[model samples]
Target: MSGHSWLLKLPLGKCKSTFNLEKAVCNHGFFMMAPNRWIPSSKILQRPLRLADNTTSVTVLISHPPDSSFLCVQVYHSQTPSPADQRAILKQVTRMLRLTMRDETIVTKFQSICPEAKDINFGRIFVRPLSLKMLSSASSFAIAGKRKRAKSEKLTTHEANNAAPMGNFPNFEELVNIDESCFLEKFKPILGYRAEYILELVEAVKTGRVSFQDLENSTEEQLCYEQVYQNLAKIKGFGHFTCANVLMCMGHYEIVPADTETLRHIRQVHGMKNCNKKTMEEEVRKLYDKYAPFQCLAYWMELLDRYEYKVGKLSELSSSRYHLISSVLFQEDTSNK
Candidate 1:
């Protein structure tokens, strides 16, 4: 594990014209979550990816040159990965960056209708969560770890233990095989109830009650949005907001997750004083209806614009500063409006 790293270059193919690694990785908050690190100085994203064997996870440094046709993935490991491992690494990177032909088409179509989105390459963004299981685990991590902090707060010993340079999540199958206590012990400092829901979802997937193939469109025939929505809704703890967010990650963008952030965007950007929780979804739908199938992307671009405006470039925002990225930090002044 101490030898020189091996580099693998993946051609961008149809996505070459629009793929910008910085925009792709930096546009989403998920990139700031555990295990993913973006270095601003070098414009490289580093993350530990679990190989197909489910036993070995390798740290990979990913970057794309300004006009190059290939995306460079540098695997930091003692041995060169086998062909299977290389495919696994590339697959994970592709999923994380949304670099498929379908994604390129979505970006092209989205920009054609919303010209303002072209500059930021909104379609190239939307990095998928490492896995659905990781989302729940990460959420539990965030919730149970919340506390008041000063601007210069140092990492506590507990936090330091949890914040391994190479993150601590096991592969999906590996996670499914673990007993409840083992799972909890591994994901220490997590909300107990949140951890329960994560286990439940994992069990459901393992038992064929819900299929990731259907959710992620790995099947030969694609399931309609309604079908996928209903499937995800059956999972405990997956409300409208969670389902929609998950759906967006799965490449369905017609539905936007209308949380408090959406309400804030509606109020500040659209001047909707009365857009409360009840009317938030309706208001957001109306705002981005023109974007149609790409409604989430459109809404996300607006939010990203406001975020970067307030916090400066996300690429430059250190991973250590991720804890400071709360809604209050990006809240805009709207009293005069």
Candidate 2:
């Protein structure tokens, strides 16, 4: 685990195909999860991994065999990573590969609920509803002048409840991603109005109107997926497509966060020979209606099948595939859903 990066064998207990590995590290396709710098391709995923302390950066190559039981991760650098760094790498790997691990009982329960999804490589695409943790972190809130407190000094339940101002608990960056200058500069064409909406989202987070954790636990709190969807829809810049994908990321699979790519895939794979935006959406909802509450996951699985068959992997395809995911205009009155 040290001295000029080497290879390590880690078990992939629940992942059935190496294609899941591609999806795990490749969040947006053709583009990395912003600020993480995860480079992905058909055969390998490369990333500059920071140790848990953030003082060091190490590059690693990740891959696995299709349908194999274990993943092969290679850490390559001039210096060896520490044990903590190795653990960080593993933890991040597990996060991106959510449903592919042995110990994630939440994923298992979700699979039990959606047995139809047993064949789908669920991955981070789904999460345990109430217990799901948003990917927001202290660094995300640092721009607002809130720094994390000492980790060794744990807060009690009561202090934690009253500790909103104690540290950088508000994560404005996750939505706007101000940390990545490159994304803000060059990708303005991609995120245009959504970028403005992120500022509103940060305000919502800061004002305690909509906590990220609230969205995470919405399902358990008697908020039906649609109610939560409406709640999120109330936010500025959130339309059918943005709200849907946001909820999907928060573990709601009832909707597919549909876009033109969805339209294209439905046209190409579902045998819908001709389709405008309305027809494409109707076809998708019809195709996955039987799998309601699991439609997003189901749709993603189908799309992934076609995607892997086409390129054998996923890059930051989210932005590149749907070049106009948010900003593109569709047929009149068709809406963004």
Candidate 3:
């Protein structure tokens, strides 16, 4: 665990006034998932980042010193990371924090449209996709395959006896080059039919059946969101919810990834009593149409507020309490009865 430590500074640019590290990192549930840890005491976000070598993972601590204008990324490693490795680490951190000018503009515009979100600075947080391959697999697993206790128990067992810790979840290159048997064996705990979907996505990428170049470059002119959505729909196990979630990660926010929870939110918050599975999409579209391109952000802002109302401030939530999040939500639902 011994390693050299050094800091790399990234300027906040126009985002300095709007950015709050705690608010940005804790704004999303993915922060509670594997590999990402937000230390409340130190006000540092720590995670193990895979270097360019792909084999070497260095622990990185990201913090913004009080009254500082730049983010400090402290790399803990056996040696200073090469320039490429440093770039890789910074890229991941930037993606995780949505530190781009475009992202800041999105938040600014979103808040103007939805005054309720003006104070909270919603839509500024995002989870790292790592790569399209990982996004496909992880988003599928999260939205479709992950059940509360059942999946958690299975993943715990897998982590204990079979696969690497969740922190080292396979990267895009690893997934592409991984032996099919090894991939199946490593992910069997949560794979189920998701294995087929993940592999199908990998093969699609391998064969150039689907292009992620535009997404990687963040080039909206070259990206057709609907085409991507249609292509993803062709993959087994990718329904509307999963595809919308993937598109949202890729920066298309016109659609909300509605689920049972969304239905509840609409019924209770929006006063839409007849909103069920069949009408969920239409109802949500009508309700959040005012937000237009940032519909998902507005919807998510309300949802996150609801979660905080039930549990507590997400920024102050302890890592140890992450597991109880689902139960707490369930309890809120039942208690209303």
lDDT of 2 by residue, 209-276 (tens): 76767665675575778888987777777889988887776556688878867876776677576777
Q: Please estimate how well model 2 matches the true structure, expressed as its whole-model Cα lDDT.
A: 0.55
Off by over 4 Å in 1: 129-165, 177-192, 218-220, 327-337
Question: Which residue window of length 10 is worst by lDDT in model 2?
Answer: 160-169
lDDT of 1 by residue, 1-337 (tens): 2234677988889888888889888988888876677888989887777555644566678888778999988776546689997887898788888887777888999999899988767776656535553332231112222321211123335433422236434445545656778667756455666787888878887788877655555212456667888878988889999988877877888888888777777877787887789888777777888899889889889888878777788889887777655644444534333
TM-score of 2: 0.58
lDDT of 3 by residue, 85-142 (tens): 8887787777778888778888888888988887766767567736653243331122
Q: What is the lDDT of residue 287 in candidate 3?
A: 82
Listed in order, each prediction's TM-score against the native is 0.82, 0.58, 0.82
Of candidates 3 and 2, the better by TM-score: 3
Clashes, model 3: 0
**Stronger candidate by TM-score (1 vs 2):** 1
